[model samples]
Target: MYHDYTEPTWSAQQLLLIALLLVPAVGALLVALLPATRSRLVAVSFAAVTFVLSVLPALIRPADFGWFAYTPLDSAPVPPWIDLDLPWVPALGLEFHLGVDGVSYPLIVLTGLLTLLCCAYTPAKGLAALLLVLEVGVLGTFLALDLILFFLFFEVVLLPMYAVIAGWGGPNRRAAARKFVLYTLAGSVLLLLGVLLVVTKAGTGDLVLLAASPPLDRTTQYTAFALLAVAFAVKAPLWPLHTWLPDAHTEAPTVGSVILAGVLLKMGTYGLIRVGLSVAPDGAAWASPVLGVLAVVAIIAGALICLRQTELKRLIAYSSVGHMGFVLLGIATLSVAGIQAALLGNVAHGLITGLLFFLAGTIKDRAGTGSLNQLSGLRETAPRLAALLGFAAIASLGLPGLAGFWGEAFAVIAAVDRGGPFWTTLAAVAAVGGALTAAYFLRLLRRVTHGPATPEVRSVRPAITATEWLAWSPLILLTLAVGIAPALVLSDTALPLATLLGIQP
Candidate 1:
């Protein structure tokens, strides 16, 4: 039943996903073609339109929704909601397909929401066009179900992002962009090889089919999974894989950092859950313990480093390492609760950490330096900004009232339930990691938000913009809403989660 829902059958809403891809592409191209000297309003408006138009499919009733896109040439018409197919090439047994069900719906929505936010917050006309094109790439990556196609969309996300950071970033932009691309390129190469191995082994590259009847023998699967895992692990920035991130975050322009932390990183964990767990459960089970230990190390190590950091952007960057550690913990558990917790963490981290970067960028944009020692009286000078930072920070510390809490709460609980010698030993370590997170963030809050006025205040005050608040409030609101009701995500995702975990439908 879950496989039936996800196959490449073209439904009406599924076609909307295609439109979601095309509309932004067209609009962004137009923006790019426009003269750079023109008012940036045109670029911003075009970007905004994509966000407004995205609601078309999201509003569809569950009953009306099915997944796929088709063309008249060799396939059926793309449905308004779904698309499915078993393609030709019997010799190879491969199918070209695409679809989305409830599990992927949140990411689809998040990509749309963050793209819109990116559109709203972007300042440069040239860059606005690039950002819109980037949004299309992201949306495509989320919706694609074909392995080869998915790889293409995944690669598409990188170029625009590379351009955005290098073209518009601070003084260190070139180095950051290079580092970001090098890491992602290395990951993408591994993903490509993994995709090739699966196709070569199983004679099909359709994600739906692969998930339904996975490719590769146990040895081959283990090898293929290592390639895929390391590829995604880099993107997930798990512990040692995370070094590229802090530099990227510190140097990236506001919107670049926003999208990077918000949507791009989740792509990795999403792939791990969707493709890795579903298609290579045995390998995933094999890798689970190692992932657990690393999770604890990342949580603890990231927190420890943050305690030593004086740079505000770098501190927030390290906090991401800690927060994402919870995400890893959830993935490592190999339980439904753990998977769900990882998903929860994905969404929460996007909201909370992305918000932190946004507000941190605002402060840095004002104060001339992101160094914590140079900052003081932020609350007095830019109270709204201080407030946004506080909300994002406390949430990062997993305060119960916000979105960040549930992923950790669920992960720790799941770890305990997945108990035994190693799991329990490591989970206890993760629990201690939690305390470290709280300790450092609280210290950061005091030093940044609760200090006497300094020369920075006069500078920070004048730069506060209404536009920043407008862009930030929605994320903060979602953080609060999801904290109160995580079921919105978990419920919709249950069937897909069950399928991935090999639970009976």
Candidate 2:
């Protein structure tokens, strides 16, 4: 929110936010125009170039590095302390208002980072376009201030993701994509309805205005909450709503899985915070218990499923359910620590789960399958790969010095801080989820990392290529950086977190 000029200077939001759309738009066209024979080159170049371009905004207008204390005792500004507005649709009372605050910035940076990483690791020629398109939608969703614009970005995820999964996924992909779409679509319909209801009741859909002055009666709020929550919940893939994930993750190609885990899943959690909490505080408070119970179920059930899965991709996919359960639990707490944990968890899952999928894909490439029973003794032929996998696993299992720990640890600690029978018990369940996470990772390790080589395991290949390392190293380094210095992240998030969570210090 630090801008030298109020109106004279070119806005970073103007340059950076608009660039997100333009790059992908142009990149997609360029990719399509390239000779088919250089299709691989085109895909790689488009991704690589687009990634470099993504950093321009950050380099040009570096994010302000400061913390917003959450207590009432400290003075902190509510975010977008600097704001930008451009008229796009006047009838709707909407403008292209873009600005950075504690909440949006990290999510924005994470989306940009992962999109670039995705472009790096993403290989499918036909599907890369959709991924780029998905990036546009996600980036827009995070930056958008209009309620309808936000919803558009939210639903933009539907088609491109469906196309990616259906076009590039495994044998059963069509069905998996269909199931994924049907659920999300039903949810989107409800989301649209809630949007209309809010706009009708509140007289405006501008998120800034809505957040400034949310309307609707308590009854209407709860009704809208249920509808919108169901819609976002489908995305959150919470408990019963999560049936589509394992199949989607299992069937999706590596990069597809990566984006799915890395960014798409966070959309659900993001909506919970952005739309659910921000627009429907009363409803959110009312439904917190429902979210809380479902989170507990997901934590316990997802962990148990991970323990049983024999396929590496499926295991990681299920682990997402558990990881995201903590995200929901954090949101449910309705406290700054809880919300911060959820935000932290969002970034952590993107790093850790993305790495796990990437490594799993590498193992599958060398070994010809992702089935654990068919592979063993990765240490013998691919010791370095084994080490990377170990690193990702233990980190995901919530090892203290790693990125994954904070999300889960903070969620549980925040829940404990909330100190209710429900919160305390769910905290205990999430802790068990944590322990079970460690158990399964350890189990996967025992099964795949060491001991005498089975025929399938012994056939493991050499170290990852330079390209692969480049694709993965950022995520690896980020995991360590965030884990070691979460304050760096937390500092960036403080104001937005305080504003959204209604904390003022």
Candidate 3:
């Protein structure tokens, strides 16, 4: 179990949490009501404020108590840095609970930053408002401490994303949007069932309480974890459930793809840690082998498939399946090192993959085609773009000093730490998958960045735009920063993960 830092009275911390959700919510409305001409400025302003506010929570010190302060007899597992709880639908056993800690703070900031960048980059008239609305859902999902509230926030992202894709996406927008919705809705149904089961059985929707003392029996815990895991896997789009992602990325607009790949997919991995494992440790233990196996499968399958992909966006989309497989693998280890690596992997994937989509979108837009065969010799025309793409690809392939390396490398280390034949085999196979990851990315760079300039490449603009630099620079810098110093994401995570997993500090 963890400790709680709940306060009886409202404070500046509480106000900031409320504002994180409200600013986006209010901004969505204002963007709709205000002139479209001013929408970009207004949306960016709100997103910027929210991003700034999200960072403030991290500066608020965690309670002075250390992880070693607790004993095995104690029941405090994961503690919030700051939390606010109020009665909401008491009859339904729900509360208006909100909180943030080491685990959630990084993701909240990532969501805010990506939303701000997307808003700044997109010029579509009404899309800015929709992006804000999506921000509200994602930010709320990361903030909510109530299970029911989390579900509501999670659902909130569905429609706005559908609208973004269907309204502003490419030629087959409607079809891609339909598939995305259908697959996720199916996952949501399972997610809802799991939430209702846990709440009804435990008689409370407060996640902190549930994490501290899971009330379900072994059987019920197994059932709940299974439902939640499968539901999140759909969002994580693990392996076979990942088919929708390629099409969605292939058709959605650039900003839409950025948000989708950047922060939205994180909801699944976050839920697995916060809800599935925290609320049902026995079940997580029971299912780790299966989870580990499947994650390995996803890693191998996604890489092999990417090797065969022809379209640029579709290949990047498939790569997510493999990257997220590392995350899921880390979670399956259920060690402090594994979970910490999972969190770092989550943030790194967001930065690197988000940049990849941005560059791919720009290339597709300028070249008038996304086909790898028709796109070549990018360095001859767009040297800067090619260089950035090369950096992103290398980072995605887990280059030693970059953001992507630590999470994946540590995930394997954590598995080795687990020290069993089964996990050892999974680690070996996953290592092979890593090698395959490098192969496909190098193949991608060769096809898209090297070789002689094609007709499409010759016609493309060589200069990078101010908006592109504005949006991509931060990701570039952060990817390098996090890669060089992973402690940026991992510093606050140890205590929470240790307590949550019952591992001694």
Candidate 4:
């Protein structure tokens, strides 16, 4: 028997998800209203709440649903589980859309954890509000379902990060901050143009819609991809375009560097997958070989740069370039395995590199300098610190049974399995770069942690602080956990990626 039925106006679960997404922004506002002395506590509480909320969706196993609907040229109703799709500036065809899927949920959790950790670890007064604000942007970027909404969230990250660098960083902070803004803003312009072209051409800004039915023809897809690639590349800070990173890492405060390495850079790689490949598949295929070559070069070049780097933070920054290269290489292969590797690499790099920067900052703060040559014999004077540094160093160098290994190994494996002359060559070069990565990190270990105590090291006092330990333990434990069971990240990513790639899960 058939019966008339109506869907509830909105499910409680959907409303809860929307509440989770907005929690940080509301918290940021509340934080701003609080007394300066209480800001940290308020920010932490709200961040913790947001983190809890972010985790809820995973537990409940929500299905896809729509928030609000709109008329389109194609006249198809939007998909479900969109959560919020209210029309905004209907004349421009923009909507305030936000939602999540397997691809984005892990990143949302990463963003929440990193931001909370940064807030807990940072000693700078009057900054918790900004960090909370930044957290909102990072989470929103991952969850945003509309192109315009995504861009807004993406741009929201730029300003707070700039403030963090300029206000809390070291001697060269202002210059580093300016360079960061200029490079990113230039990229943002291109990103906006690309988004506009796609939305205008497709007559919709809905990412799900665009993915289901590419809005543009092949030639237009190619053009859109080119513009979008340039934008994301600058943010990924790919080789030749990567000049802004080392200085930013070196000059920014420890928390800033941690966030930069841990989550912000992921935005670029995520964009490449979410927007570039999905929206412009033909263009991505055409560009894959060239991108693979560039990824290989970035791998080698970043390692080479690390070999010459003397500053601890700069070395870690350069290391990020190489690690992210593995991610880009995996993406370039355009296979299920390659993309999965890229996803794994993305999370692993965030965890390992974040830990590395934190340790580097701790060492520098205690020793009063970051110069590897001048800072020696940490093993003798600061055994605990040296031991932690050694642990982080090995993990970052892709030691077996560490978080870094699975991603780097799988990226190379995927390239080999891709079975083309270009991919084969790229795989070989990347493997060699992996060796170079180990060498440079070993060199860093020898120069900074293994020698006789330097005068600075001998005079240093204070072990790792409670806040530092609290902030670090998660990354350290997660590194080992993921190392031992890469399936934690891989399993969640596999089906979503297969969907993205039009392959069977």
Compare the candidates by lDDT and give the number of the best one: 3
lDDT of 1 by residue, 69-154 (tens): 11222222112234434464556554545565555667777777777777778767777888777787777777777777777888
List the candidate numbers ranked by lDDT, top first: 3, 4, 2, 1
- Displacement of residue 76 (Cα, Å) in model 1 is 22
Superposed by TM-score, candidate 3 places the C-alpha of residue 405 at a distance from the truth, in angstroms, of: 0.3
**CA lDDT, candidate 3, residue 281:** 90
The models' CA-based lDDT, in order, is 0.77, 0.79, 0.90, 0.83
lDDT of 4 by residue, 144-164 (tens): 878888889889989998998
TM-score of model 3 (CA atoms) = 0.96
TM per candidate comes to: 0.91, 0.93, 0.96, 0.93
What lDDT, from 0 to 1, does candidate 4 have? 0.83
The CA lDDT at 304 in model 4 is 96
The digit string of per-residue lDDT tens for model 3 on 297-396 reads 9999999999999999999999999999999999999898999889999999999999999999999999999999999999999999999999999999
Candidate 3: worst-modelled 10 consecutive residues by lDDT: 64-73
lDDT of 1: 0.77
What digit string (tens of lDDT, one per residue) describes model 2 on residues 1-505?
Answer: 2223333434654665677667776776666676656655665665556556554443444334335343222333354633557888787676777655567666667776776676666555666667777887887787777778888888888988998889888889999999999988988999999988887888877676566446667887898788888888888788878989999998988888998899888888888888877777889889988888898899999999999999999999999999999999999988888888998999999998999999998888778888888777889878899899999999999999999999899999988998878789989988988999999999998888878777776677675788788879999999999999887457656556655655552
Task: List where candidate 2 sits over 4 angstroms from the true fold.
Answer: 1-12, 37-77
What's the number of clashes in each of the models? Answer: 27, 2, 7, 5
lDDT of 4 at 203: 87
Find the candidate with the highest TM-score and give its number: 3
